[model samples]
Target chain A: MNEREPGIDRRQLLKGSLALGMASLLTPRVLRANDSSTVTLPFERGRRPLVAFPQKRPLMVMTTRPPQLETPFHIFNEDIFTPNDAFFVRWHLANIPREIDINTFRLTIRGRVKQSLTLGLHELQTQFEQVEIAAVCQCAGNSRGFFQPRVPGGQWGNGAMGNANWKGVRLRDLLQRAGIERDAVQVRFDGLDQPVAQATPDFRKSMSLPDALQAEMLVAHSMNGEALPLLNGFPLRLVVPGWYATYWVKMLNDIEVLNQADQNFWTSQAYRLPANPCHCVDPGDALTDTVPIGKMPVRSFITSLENGGTIPGGERCTIKGIAFDQGHGIDRVLFSVDGGQQWQSARLGKDFGDFSFRPWEAQFIPKPGHTYALQSLAINRIGESQRFGARWNPSGYLRNVVESVKIHAS
Target chain B: MIPVWMFLLLLVGATGFAWGSPANGNDREQGSILNLPADPISFQPGPGNDLASRYCLMCHSAEYVYTQPPHPREHWIEIVNKMNASFGCPISDEDMTPLVDYLVTQNSLQPSPSAQHVQRDDLKETPGQSSTQSGDPQKGKTLYGRHCVTCHGPDGKGDGPIGQALVPPAANLTLLGKQSDQTILDTLRNGRPGTAMPAWKNDLNALELNHLLSFLRTLSP
Candidate 1:
């Protein structure tokens, strides 16, 4: 079991050294006010710098204070399980915990329970039946940059999502230990992060008691078989499988079982989607009804060949990518080399789990000097496929539009 | 060869030391600490730029404002009011107009070309001569120290304290001596798309930009 540690450590070290060498070589000696190195996304004002944070390789920087770092799209093609260092990081509040004492850290279960209990890291690890599952944790605004007519939040590209094998004790076991009362209605989670102002609502989220008791819900202390990074919530965090990352509260320290519904700002006001079947509304239309953003919709991506990339002409080339949905599992991935006109089945790769990124590949022979529009459509077991065009909304959430990449055969 | 039990004992010892033992009574050894890098970008100079720095930076960084898509005046007003009303930003009624005005000036979409030209004409009294004369590099250096040094670094190596944390990082200006003045001037006027670089069209006039460009030339080897 421990044999893989040396291999993973060596590989990471080599990658880190190579990346540093390339950065030094490509960096110019002279700098100007307007001359910062940048990678431009395929949208207006999409130029972003690549910065490295602790325990992470160079990733796209969206904000500096709360540190919303996005993984590069190329990392998706590397492996089915995203390396813990390469996983994306997002925090809502600025004053996040920079230090955590594992020995002193405690997971408190209180409110509406038969008994309040606080479990230390060692107790939580040893007393419960340890379980492991591979799941995809994605931000609700993963592809907000692609939204036409634009939106006003973090303008991220398609790099704000990642899949990983999470290891932890089940939340159900912890709730059972605390003994839920008959009046329990909801389970609210609070993290170590705090708002700058007292009046500003603290970052908190809740789910129905039934939803929280799902067997898949975990109070994870380890990610990808290692202690969670401080930025990704070190001591402990909640892992809500198949749900948006917003509900997977990082640096989780408190779990309060409430007798009534949660009316916090993050619950009632923020992260709301239009309450429609499509979760969409006409652009510029006022939202009459809204609901808290939940389960991620079906999505897919072509990770191997990027837009405007060149492929070998008059030869067979293997096109590869990843496909995933909010659990039901990807039924079949349809590949179109002619921009959705012709559809061909791509062979699906090994299954990690229902809540994991399933790899898929297809073969294509391109004619020399021909430009082809490549697209992938992921259909789940429930027959939910990606929309041909992007859905519009004021907040720009849940954009699972059929992604098209225009590439030329060399 | 070491016995298997002996090896296991050594492994347990190492693990305990690495994570810290409660018996040691050293709190510092038990927890891990991380020091995040500083931020370099700030709001562009305008009527209420100071107010924005005072109030907004209390909760988030300036990139939150700089990164937004160019919105209309109404959008800026709505966001500001939301921060005050919902997020509890402490802007008073008197400071509201100036704060919104500053935001609109820096981040709002540009007017039509004809109207823009008219505004430009109004700002510059001697627009014709401003382009003809070269600027003083010494004067440019002072301006660079004030604005460019934050992200570009004092030596123009893009190693500024805050620039270290930026994605794609701040540009290394020392290698740009070979580039033409027009290219640099154009970038200064229009700004690079999707980058933290903001256009100096409203902040700096043509002559001041030329001075900044002259100072930038000195960064090249």
Candidate 2:
């Protein structure tokens, strides 16, 4: 059996074991603000001894008011389905619903429809076909904290993502009842979330009319076979499989069908990406034309071993992790143990659909006195692979670079 | 390697990891109550500190200003104007300058140290040439005040009234120090595309452009 030395500082361990090519692999656990100057580092590590709030387990708190919480990296190693309480929380506005009355809650479907229907919470659950899907909901800014020349926005670690079994009615079913008008050009979504100041833009987003009618889209009320957590949008949240979390509106109350394209701030200005293939450009390069951030790219994370953790030398060890992509599905996952000079395929775990996280495992026998530089690369069915380096954008969206981690073998 | 029993325990004991699973979660009327945490963030004191508190603090926390990557004074002006124009903050034209001044003092952006190594040169119009003593700094300062201060800010931080109205906003002049002198000259002659900056080829003579470039160099923190 392998044993680790007790109480080795993770920072000192990283300082000792960080390889020449693995500089990007290591970061401070948390970027603490200096007391006098109040300055924080560009990137931050996860907060330990997690802070608990509401129905949530101790999560890494990014902000308290709107409640931006991040999942701890270690929890990814536990199960394929991220627990509801452990899931991350992100809110664009400050006035999030504190107390939701189930009896009075109504989901109003109006605008550009023949019949406008407002359904209560009970009717929303029992009236439609109950379906369950295991999908991943990841923020567009999942790894924004790691960005070099870091941009302005919520600086987040990899924990801003989770895979859960979502249970609800198909959005198509709800739209059918409302009878969408032929002139409808787009479908807009709004939630109970509102800004404190009237000047601040309301949190609203829209999908093209055709895209909104897709069969996979859902109005999820239950996560992981249980009622949605208060922080995770208790009453209902839209589940747009394979899309970023921004498109998945939580605490949903209004579904308006627009005859013309949406001109809202969230759609017209924010969450936009450069038209480039990787959406990357040099720092300060002008992005004149842009498009909305849509489907996510291929990504993988080695969660089984903690960064700078130690392993027993001359003994075989199993490297386990998870890989995912947009609903195109994960084609294969490759592990690189020698700074990406070579790669070998890892064994795939159970199939949980294209939108769900797919776990993988590989065996490695460490050589004594050598530091193992480990990396995982995932490719989707469309042959899209994770980039070796992270890209930059003004909004800091859709960062899907291949992840690297290192461990010492003593 | 992990023992088979431990592996089995991982799969079987998955639910145990959840600290508190609510009782009667399936009950329809037993609604979940979420109490949002109080706002614990406040702004740091700097120049025009009261203006920042009066205008900016009304909408969001001070974390927004403190967390931004350090930018030039002109950039702060654009941001302030955006707050006024886009978000409808009631800061008048007089208060705008001081608010921007405060933001510029606070923003001492340091690029990620690790990221400095891979900095790309291909993005610039002209590469490799450093600053040269072609323009007079005194003349440049005068030219900046007359032609540029309204948009690029008096300090060239891009915090001008018109700059904030632009879609992409004005470029922070302080960051231009890393560019070749020729690149800065060309950008002035041929304004950036997909932005509000316009070509100044006809607006200023070559000597005046050089003078403005020299003055911009002084704005670098």
Candidate 3:
């Protein structure tokens, strides 16, 4: 719809096309100060989990408000893992870093480390042990819509999660290189993508020293064995497998080792777990204890046979989904047919590697001509039981609730 | 694929509300996160909204407010007031009652989601004047180019950075050039009353204003 606008020179067309991953960079346009021009404002995909997903070639369909997948997800092209171009694109800001000039990009290391240093993209790629982990990064708010009280954020019915084989240097090795100073309490992270707010640009976050220096932590550079997508933090991003996608700060720039944790809002007073166990209470009654949104709470979800799903009655069909608790691995996945009554153990799949998402599947022959409610739940070895409903938190933190799928019979 | 099943949206909020199935603390919601226990019960004044968003979203986009949550209201209020005081909320003592009325009526008492709530030491400082006249095309183009291009297209169309997300979109800058100088100047100095346009009186100087206004006049579309 935009390329047709009058007077937008070929240069602007080139820029717009490039942003849409359409054209290649041919020549640079000299940006004039007084030239009134339109820029790509960040179109936040709050209405849908993934705003722009390719349904057909050259046919870039934009979702209404926030884009949502109207059709049920059917597994196709499953053989060679997720196709490169068909991979999902997730962005949090409009000003996504277009190009990563590995030349001057630097990663600063500070805080509870013996020495603070800045490493370039090239250094990040070549200096440490290059390892690739097939993991899935999901926004904590991925299935936030699943929460009751119709909490408003991204009305993502699902779609916010994606599995990727990420390549990068181990964060632990880098931390050791910086030498964690004694009394180190936490490690903080910030991105180069400055969110220009009414206030100054403060697009940043932090992590505990243990979480940052964990063996599984990685400063990723590639996804599905390719250079990171510009929107996915081209040069680098933090890969906190098994945890919510929040800590995976993209366009990674700063890594601080704090002897005494940083007092930033992202860490101190925000992104915390609930102070109560139920969704019924005065939020003011709950003590606002600022804490880290650590290891994703153990949870499970049904990928196949989605809510309101339909299947041929009597046809033997398999119910499937991927589930694994971060840190404390998943020991068992349970499936229920009668709304949590009579739970059956689902067949577990082979582990796909470290800090990576494991896709689990369970099969069942549906009763001919019967609409059944299907539910999948997982329990981490830590004994965290995935519940059936969600609770209320001031911030809506950690929705590890067990998700239910409604299957319809034809 | 998007899940077809309609999920429950009526979540318990954190703003100390007294609704729905009484709040639960030290107990997990049925079918929610494992035995690890349900998150603390929250009561946002807005049932559909959580505290973090209810407050912050009033002035800005919900996407900006909710991406990161669990912040204290002080910080939230700081952000709300920041946009109101610094970015451009356009309210005075006279309008304060209406403004607060709109806010207090909100289910959320937390800060509104808005542009950054940056606390700058220089906000109280008076703006410096520009060198160019307000209508000089060369000067106007130069000034407008720097400040207007992000939301308004180079040719004066509404296609800048924030323009795409706006409801009515931004005004076509080039078209404004045809309007009276008084209208243009007033809009520039005080900003369009109901838009995302900030008061340029603080960000621009007289000469810069002249140049921006002049360039804006040239574009007919």
lDDT against the true structure, per candidate, is 0.75, 0.72, 0.52
Top candidate (lDDT): 1
Answer with 2 or 3, whichever has the higher lDDT.
Answer: 2
Q: Find the 10 residues in a row with the least total lDDT in model 2 chain B.
A: B113-122
Index of the highest-TM-score prediction:
1
**Model 3 agreement with the true structure over B1-221: per-residue lDDT tens digits:** 32211111111111111111112221212111100101111112333233222223223333333332333434445445655554433334443433334434342444322211122112322232332242578766776665666567777688754554443467876555345565566456544322345445434555566677667667865
Off by over 4 Å in 1: A1-37, B1-30, B108-221
Best by DockQ: 1
What TM-score, over all chains together, does every model reach? 0.74, 0.71, 0.61
Q: Candidate 1's residue-wise lDDT over A1-410, tens digit each?
A: 13123324422332343333211111111111223434568886565666555555556777766778888888999988887667888988776765687868888999999999999999998999999989999998888988888887888899888898899999999999999999999999999987655567889999999999999999998888777777788778899988999999999999999999899999989999989898898888899899999899999999999999999889998999999998899999999999999999999999999999999999999999999999999999999999998999988799899999999999
Candidate 3 ranges with C-alpha deviation above 4 Å: A1-95, A198-201, A276-287, B1-215, B218-221
The order by descending DockQ is 1, 2, 3
- Between 1 and 3, whose TM-score is larger? 1
DockQ of candidate 2, scored on C-alphas against the true complex (2 decimals): 0.10
Compare candidates 1 and 2 on lDDT and give the better one.
1
Per-residue lDDT of candidate 3, residues A1-410 (tens digit):
12122443333333443343222111111121122311111222222122122110110111211111221133311422343334443443333343456677888888767888789876776778898887766666655544444443444434455667888999889889989888987887888654323333354677767777667788997777666544456568888887777788888988887777677755665456654444333444454544556666666667665567688877678777777667566778998877788788998776776354556777777786787878888877777777666765645556667666787777
